[model samples]
Structures are given as C-alpha cells and as structure tokens.
Target: MVTRDRCRGALLGLAVGDAMGAPTEGMTPEAIHAAHGRVEGFLHTQASGTDDTEYAVLCAQGLLAHGRRLTSNDVAAVWTRAVLSQDGGFHGAGFSEMGAIANLRAGVAPPVSGNDNHESWSDGAAMRVAPIGVLCAGDPVEAARLAREDAQVSHAADGIYGAQAIAAAVARALVTDDHTEVIAAGLAAVPEDTWTARLLRQALDVASHAAGMAEAERELYRRIPLFHYPWPDSAPEAVALAFGLFAAAEGAFVPSVVSAVNIGRDSDTIAAMAGAMAGALHGETAIPRAWRTKVRQVSGVCVTATAGTDLVDLADALYEASQGNEEYENAT
Candidate 1:
C-alpha cells in the first residue's frame, strides 16, 4: 500500500526539513532561540538542502539501479562513480562519508572501509536511509536489511543500527497512523543491547513526560551522554533525538520537523529523519505547499551530480520499483 503521495512525502519532506534546519545546524537550542527566535518556517528566502538531501538522492538512485538485490558492492560502485569521481572535494559531506571516501581511494572495501574509519558511529547513514523504507513499505524487516546494505558501506555498529531504525520506522509509518507503533517497529530492527536502542528508549521516556518541545530538549540534553567530541553527529544521539521529537509531536509533519530544527545540534539531519517518518505516516498532503515546493529540486551543494534532480520523480520511480520487486518476488 505504498501510495504515490506517501512516497513523495518521504523524499520531499526530508529535503524540506534539511533545508529548514540548515541555518541552525550545529548551534545549541539556546543559541537557536537567541538567533532565530523560534524558527517557525524557512530562514532563507531561497532555501536549499545540504549534504543530507544530496546523499538521499544518491541513495534513491542506488536503490533504483539495484532494487531489492542492492549489495554493499553495488553501493560502493555507485559511490565510486557518483561521489569519488567528482571533480571537487565533497564539500559539505559528513565525516563518516569522508572517511569512507578516503578508504575507498586507497582501494579498501566496505565493512573494512567503514570499520577502519574514525567516524563510523556518526549519523551519516541514518540521514539518507529513508528511501529504503519507502520501497519496503509495510515490511520493516526488509527495509532494515536493505538499509544495512547501504549503511555498511560507510558506517558500523550504532551508525548502521540508526539507519536500520529509521528505515524500519519509515516502513511502518507508511502503513500505520499510530506513531508509537511506528517507533516500536524501529526499535525492533536493532538489538536491545546496543547504544542506539538504549538511547532511543531513554529519549522516548523523557519525551513522554515533557510538557513541550523545550522541556523535551532540556531533558534529552541532560539525560543523553554524548561523546566528548567537537562534533554532535553521534548516530545514537541524533536518531534518539529525532524519534523522541517525532513521538512528542505525535507524528505531525511540521511540528516534528520544526522541533528537531529548533532543538539544534546536527539539526538538518535530525529534522530530515523526523520529517521522513512524519511524512510517511501522513502522506504528501501533510507537508505544507510552500515547503514542498522549495525542495522539489535539489541544489546539489554536496553531490554535484544530483543537482537539479527532482525528488518527486525519484519518489515515483521508487514506488514503481517497489511494485516491480513485489511482482518479481511473487513470481519467484
């Protein structure tokens, strides 16, 4: 039951959220409030998505090219052609991706490329995994499996787990209106003993009791123990924060994405992930017309080849690919 609207919403919502959150990224919640005074909408007149949206487009292309048979090698091959061969440096790409690219340049393969990287626990994988969910709608297990295939190329452990969680959640959201159930599906995709799982549970617990987004932010900031690093791209923390905000907002598209943006700290990726879940739950109609229109075509600030790519067309192609996979699976 993966309708066209839901498919459009997932990709468009992710791009819009990434754009909306870009201005406030890396700032603290207090800093965001001090600067923007509660970001209710887009900060710039002509907003554009950053690396988050570009990487997502890359992922959608990968899925379309390989379908359900997508492997880590397939992902690496795509990256080699699309990412590594690009003329300039990967401008706004995340640390994990840069690490993987460096490894790939040295002829190292994935799982090893990801493992040898220093930022393997970053949220880079989760930021671009929503398409796997769109294709595997109502089948969280398949979504998680495919997400791992994509993630293992540049992430490991909690990073891969975070991608799996978001993919599984988006898949469940495509079929159910209950946000709690959607979150449960995501949790089920990963091991309970993992840091991602533990942080996710704690995030939800804090969000459940909070009065509003501000309170939830405070509680999450206090409760979650972040690594003593300069960057705030921890996969476990970002996924936990995104899902917690999604739960708090009860899966409302605008509110969930906006809250994640305002909460700051890797805001673009956090909002993008939340927006993907909410969009899957509610469909394209839930996204505001203005926001969706702004992100229809990516700016390709990170992945140059994805410039001018229309998310709507990609979404439709993904939906059709999903149908083809279903037909093939049935025939087999």
Candidate 2:
C-alpha cells in the first residue's frame, strides 16, 4: 500500500507548503491579507524555501546522494553545507543553522548537549522535518528519536517535540490506512507538558465542531495564546497549523496547506508541516494537480514538485532499513 508515489508524496506534500509559504513565512495573518489579498495563489513559491522544509530536503538529498543511509556526522555535514549557501534549503538561519555552521567550521559535528535540556521551541524543526517521519515507517518511537536528533541540530524542547509528533504521525501512516489514526498517532507523539502538546489538546477538544479551518483557526488562536510569544507564536504556528490540517481533513492538499498558512502566526512553517503530513496521508494524488505542476516548473534550485524523490522512497527505504537493522542487531 505504501507506493513509491506515496513515499515522495509525504515529503513533497510538506515541500509544497514550504516552497509556497517561503515568501510569507514571517507575516502575520492581517499582514498576509493586506499584502497578498485573500492568501490564495502560490504566493510563497516564487522564491526558495525558508529554514523549515528546506533543511529537511537537504538532509534527504544528502542521505540519498551519499548513500541510502545517514549518520549523525552525515546529518551535520549536509546541515553545515546547507547554511553555507541557499543549497541547504534554509531560507534564514536559526539555532540549528548556527550550530550546524559552527560544527562545519570546526571541521567536526557539533557536540550533543547533556544535563540541562535546551528550551528553544521554534517551528523550524517541524517545518523541515518530514523526511525523518517518512523514514521512520510504522515506528513512532523511532520516528520520535530521529525527529529529536533532527530538531536538536538547532532547535530544542518544543522544537524537538513538534518534529517528533509529525515524524511519528508520518511513520504511523505506513501501518494503518486510516486518516483518523494518522492524526491520532501524530497527536500521541508529543508530551502533555509542551506547547505542541497543549495545542493538540486544545484542538482535540474542539476538532468536532471546529468544522472549517477559519473557525478552527480562531478557536486555536484563542486557546494556544500566540500573544504570549515574543516572535508572534514563538511556538510558531505549528499548533494552529496542525489544528487546521486535522480540521481540513476533507479538503485537498493546497487548501489544507493554505488553511494552515492563513490561520496566522508561523503560517509558512505550519503550512509546510500540514502539507507534509497531509501529503503523506493522502499521497501524490492528494495534492492539487495544477498547483503541483506550477511548482515543478517554477522551482528554484533544490525544490521539485513532481518527478523527484519523495516520502515513498523514504518509506520503502525505511522498511528496508528496518529489515537490515533488525538483522544487524540479531547478528550482533
């Protein structure tokens, strides 16, 4: 059931939002409306991606190019190089980018932190995190573990939790074919203490009547309380976006992603996360054909809309990886 198309579908679904939302990443809901008007077109597609999904592709490209596997060292290298130029897919630098650049400059991978846990909760990790999820394949624990590594490369705390949630959800997609289960699995990944967790809790309470993204967005804004964060949602829009993605389950990929983007704070990253998750859940056909076709043609350097490697590839690889890993462990 996990076709090659679906493999790529998951990441591409994430990328569709990433590339489309790149231009609008930082703008507020009102600002987005004032500038873009109605927030309809592929407004974010004209340029490259921001830090979220771009870094995700970088890791994927690196893993694929270097061989079908990645070590922490390989991750550091790709992330290091990703920041040096736009090729890495980072739109702008964040804590992860800084650590990556620092490590590369030091001619080594960054040291893993210990003892005190870092508390950064940016959406960057969530934005660019689908590859980890796709590769996790039916294993939420492994997905969360991989997501944590991917998040800490720059983000900490909530960042790690967000990526874990998304990754676990994507990984779980390979197990059951149900959409509800997919959403449930994603929610289960994050803990109760974190912002992502709190947001999911709020969304779950309201998901039944929240109906369309518009109503869901308002409810989410009120509950998640983005006003408290210095950089808008500081938690980024991951929570609202996730809410919209779940609420907009009946809609197409573009609509789902757009809902996530327009719901306000962290629009781009939220859209990217939603897009990635929805894309994986629905597969390539889930995306709007016209939008995808346009994106493929308009893509900058690293991004691709179709005919590129995707989550399906990642999924199959994960299955193979699981077999190999199991064999290796048994041998040892």
Candidate 3:
C-alpha cells in the first residue's frame, strides 16, 4: 500500500531530517556529544530546511489550493499570504510562529489568532503537521481532523495535541507497515486524558519495553521527567521525543533519524518529526542515496513561500492530492 515511494519518502524524509538537525538546534545532549561526536552525517555542506521545511511546504500548498474544503481561514490565508506577507521576515520561525505573527499583525483572525496572547506550547504545531500527513493519506481520523484544523493557527491545548499526534502518526504511516500499528494510530488520535496523551502513553510504554538504542535512551531517561525542561521545545517535549524515537527505532529508517539528530533540544523540529515518521515507514528506498543528493529545493530561509520548495516535487503533489481525496470520499 501507499507507495509513490512512500510519498517521496515522506517529503524527502522531511527535508533530510530537517537538514540534518539544523546545526544541532540548541545543543545539549551533552552539547551534542561535545560538538558533533555522533551526528553521523550531513551536518553541513549547504544543509538547509528550517521553519520545519518551510511550514511543511506551506501545508502542502494548502492541501493543493484547498481540497477536502480546507479551511481555518484557508490555514489563516496560508499564513497570511505565504508567511505574513513576506518581505524577508519570519525566518527560522519559532515561538509558535512569533505568537501567530503577533496575532496576525493585530487583525487577529484564525481560531482567535491561535490563542491571542499566546502561551506557547511549541513544537510549532508538530512542525507543520507533515502536510496533514500527506492530506490524510490513509485517514487516521481524517489525519486527526486536518491536524486540528491546521493546529488552531499556531497551537494551543498541548500545542493542538501536538499537531494531533504527528498528524495521526503520518496518517498511520501512510497505511500500515505496522510500526506498532503506527504507534497505535497515533495513540488513537489523541485524548487519553492528554498531557499530550500522557507523554505519548508514557513514551510508547517505555519504547515498548526497551532492549536496544542504548536501552531505549536509558529507559526514556528513567521514565520521563526530562530534567524539568531544559528545552525540548515543548509540544509535550517535542511530541514525546518524537514518539520516543519512533518507539526506539523499531521503525528503523536510520535508527529513527539518527536518534532525531542526536537528541538535542528542538533539533530541527525533532529531526523533522522523526523524518516524517521514518519516511512514512520506510519508503523512497529508505532515504540514503547520499542523503538524496543533498535534498535541495528550499531557499526561502524559513517560509518566504518556501522560496523554491520542491520537497520531492511537493510530495508528488501531496500524493496526487491524496488520490483526489480518496476519489472524493468514494464519490460521496
């Protein structure tokens, strides 16, 4: 199922693990193992992708200019005409997109400007909800209700339930290849009395009873208390440390995106949401052709309409608009 080389390897493995964890975002996994002892590859040499691959290629070009009747004011007017009426602003964006661009430049519109006077919950809507998991690829609850209507606009309530649990685990990893049934369909699309679903169900039950990946990162840091937040970019700590490193790399794909770029704070949006769930559970020939020939295309340093955006030809036009929205919902 779900091919197109795993939808162009889940958007080129989320822009090659967001340009290999953009310079170790705010290092401190022991200062990224004393400054790069284990990044493994592609730390630089023109590595790019920032605002989490330009807000997931402007939400897959607004789900192909409005499909399945996309709204939330058409994703807040596609973030006010491709990033707040660009002019070399909004680069490397954060702080819930600078508090929804100061409440959409004070005109404040969109789920009330994503909670105006924002109290950020970070992970900036799970790093652009992976194009609503390629526009609801296999419909994990309509990709968690279009990722909570494009994450309220910027994020709120456990950061819009951590972008609806990584858009329902990349829409069940684009249709079953069973990584624990795609993390149990992204924890059954949220609401197990959240704190982002109890730290993603206690970090996928201690990464499903760890045995590897350094004993599942030391039994998920001795059962998650995460050193009282010294930055993991809280969308419930970067979506429970990207679903506990994709259940401690049981999903493989380069050991769950090189353990999300050596597990540093917000390391390129947790290695672009664990490289879009292990490139939608191992596709695009498991991404490694010299890092897909330096995964180029993005130039707008962080959302200037994603300057040249070509994330594997916009994920093959969002997998051909999710096969015309699953044949217009099976012809209504």
Among all windows of ten consecutive residues in candidate 2, which has the lowest summed lDDT?
Answer: 298-307
Runs off by more than 4 Å, candidate 2? 44-47, 62-71, 81-91, 103-119, 233-237, 248-252, 297-332
Residue 281 CA displacement from its true place in model 1, Å: 0.6
Compared with the true structure, the alpha-carbon lDDT of candidate 3 equals 0.77
C-alpha-based local distance difference test score of model 2: 0.60
What's the candidate order when arranged by decreasing TM-score?
A: 1, 2, 3
The runs of at least 3 residues in candidate 3 whose Cα sits more than 4 Å from the true structure, single-residue gaps closed, are 1-3, 8-28, 31-68, 73-109, 136-149, 156-230, 234-256, 259-261, 266-269, 272-274, 277-320, 325-332
Global Cα RMSD, each model = 2.7, 5.3, 17.9
Q: What tens-digit string does per-residue lDDT give for candidate 1 at 214-302?
A: 78877876776474778989999999999999988888999899888988889999999999999999988999999999999999888
**Stronger candidate by TM-score (1 vs 2):** 1
- For each candidate, give its TM-score against the true structure: 0.96, 0.78, 0.33
Best candidate per TM-score, number?
A: 1
Residue 138 Cα positional deviation in candidate 3, in Å, after optimal superposition? 19
